[model samples]
Target: MSASVPTVGSWHRLDRAGLQAVIDVLWLVGHRVVGPQVADGAIVIRDLRGVAELPTGWLDDQDGGSYRLRHDPVAGTFDHVVGPHSLKNFLFPARETIASFVQLNGSWSQTPPPAQVPPLAVLGVRGCDLAALAIQDRVFLGSGYVDEPYKSRREKLFLVAVNCRRAAATCFCHSMGSGPAAGPGFDLALTEIEGGFACEVGSERGAAVLAEAVAAGASIGGCSPEEVEAARGVPQALAARMHARQQGDGEPRPRSLDTHGIRDLLMTNLEHPRWDEVAARCLSCTNCTLVCPTCFCSSVQEVADLSGDHVDRERQWASCFSLDHARMHGHSVRSSTAARYRQWLTHKFAGWIDQFDTSGCTGCGRCITWCPVGIDVTEEIAAIRASGSGAAPPDGAAPAGAPEAGETAS
Candidate 1:
């Protein structure tokens, strides 16, 4: 069916089959489509061959240190929130070889591998992850030193973002001012309704693909007024539902930490007792940082063959929870879990703003959902804030053995 041409930001309805056609068009154009699929009992992001790869009829239940996938035939393909993976894995892989060296004639010869960058179309990306992407861009691109590998992958990326229709128990993106709704930085944004998707194009590349889909008769032109209204209402309805859920049993609705004063709140509470309380439960397993989309810590290692004829230098994902992460000479700076945890929280919430002009956390809540000990960052911040004027240090004197304020041992 031929439909009216869609203007930028206007909604266009595409049925399930039409969505498949859209994917086909992208693949034909040499874009590797990456999307969510069920793997090992959880929704995982991977290279997709077709629409059949999506986790259709599956929804996730997430809470602190917990996640379970359930079959709900009525749920849309994009119904689930987030999984253990994020866009970071694609743009910034867990392990990468920076360079390789070989001993030739008793002399070392170094060779930098050619860059392997692929054009990518990421389907079903959520808004909070988009926000996380933006923060990462600042870190990798906007910073003084540019990560060439990250830049190469990002330059060819095409984003198909999905606005959230339902909030997970661990989600607080709305509180972080990131989403429940799709925002900027996407090529196409989708809101799934009954039997179709309400799509909006955000870039020239998005517009081109959408036009191709329409020309091929994969999409019906012009969304109805009611459909448009419903598409716009998706995030609003999610927000209301989240509010109601938080206010269970007439209790006060859980509010996000006041980010405006968070820097001061954490800076002033360096010696707070809550750190000890949380450290007791923290395993220092680094699950929280690994699952976090914005945590970009990494370490480099050199591997050599048995004959020592060749060596490869690799960059691997690292976490603040690791003792080696804070090691200096013969001593570890953050000897206790308390110091490491404190460093992570303060860096994400406070130091990040100073360095990047934005918070490192997008509030996707994966850190909470995947944490083995169920350590909630929101609750931790709340506890420290509730304890006002905690053991104030003397003027011009730092806490006895505490690292300097805003100093990250990791």
Candidate 2:
């Protein structure tokens, strides 16, 4: 049978059991279905065979430098917010051999790696992550230089987005205009309701895959009036709940970021004292960049076999926090941790606009939760914005207490 396409804006209903059929359809189509599950006390996305693998009945408590998972038997599978994983890690793997060289008769022959990226079906995506994907698309696809590897893998992938019904203490995607509700760039988007899921088809493939699931005996049909209203209220309800928590006096609520004049705000505050203060707490561990959904910092290296006849060029994920990331002529320009932190922060919020016309951050808050010392980007940016000196420090103005020349900083 030919693929069936549902109306783009139409709403549908799917009982909780139908969720497993959705996974079965993807598996039947030879897709390696992946979804979130409880792993090591955190929600992590990994290859999954069925709905039983999902992190159902799990709730996450997220805050600066902390992530803890608790259980509530009645909760939805995707109640957790952004984890350490994102679509970026799947599309752009941590390591890949882009090119290889072999020597024949003392001459080298360069060959590109064969493209064999598997078709992937990723479920339980969030709106902030979808927003991050667009930013990455701008960097790797829309930028003047196209990344072939990224393009090839992206073309063969399927994405299922889930609207966020709850926000983590560290979450600020709503302030970034990215989440609390799943947005575009998904094949299928699901809003979990009391009885089941309210489904929205964002792409023809989404509809076709869902239709396949139905044909395979999955339950799917028109939503009742109440279900439709509940579906529509997902985002608004989450927003109001987050607002109430933030307004209440107690533990920190979902974070909020003021992006007004943000680019100019970061650019003009190059010499803010906050950088030094934060640097005191920063371990320069690269946790923030690694966990960030949109940060694409990486480095390429050449490896050679013992025979010296075979060589391969490999690309590895890198971080600006590394002392060697800014190395030039045997010295790192951003030698101090404070300098490196400044570079990362400015580039994430300011220089990114210049490069990709979008902020490198999606307000996912993985950086905050994963940071060992809990260096919250939102808090840091807020401090700078509040206390920025308003003067553009001269070029190469080292951060406060920066190591002197020829001194190495950890």
List clash counts for every candidate, in order: 1, 0
Distance from true location, Cα of 311 in model 2, Å: 1.8
Candidate 1 TM-score over all chains jointly: 0.90
Q: Write the per-residue lDDT of candidate 2 for residues 72-162, one digit (tens) a residue.
A: 9888877777778898889888888888999999899997687686799899999888888888888899988899899888887899889
List residue ranges in candidate 1 displaced over 4 A: 1-3, 249-255, 305-307, 390-410
- At residue 254, give the lDDT of candidate 2: 61
Q: Which stretches of candidate 2 lie over 4 Å from their true place?
A: 1-5, 390-410
> What lDDT is obtained when candidate 2 is compared to the true structure?
0.81
Pairs that collide, model 1: 3-221
What would the per-residue lDDT of candidate 1 be over residues 155-242, giving only the tens digit for each residue? 9999999988977778877667777887789998889988788887788888888878777778546677888788989988987776
- TM-score for each model: 0.90, 0.92
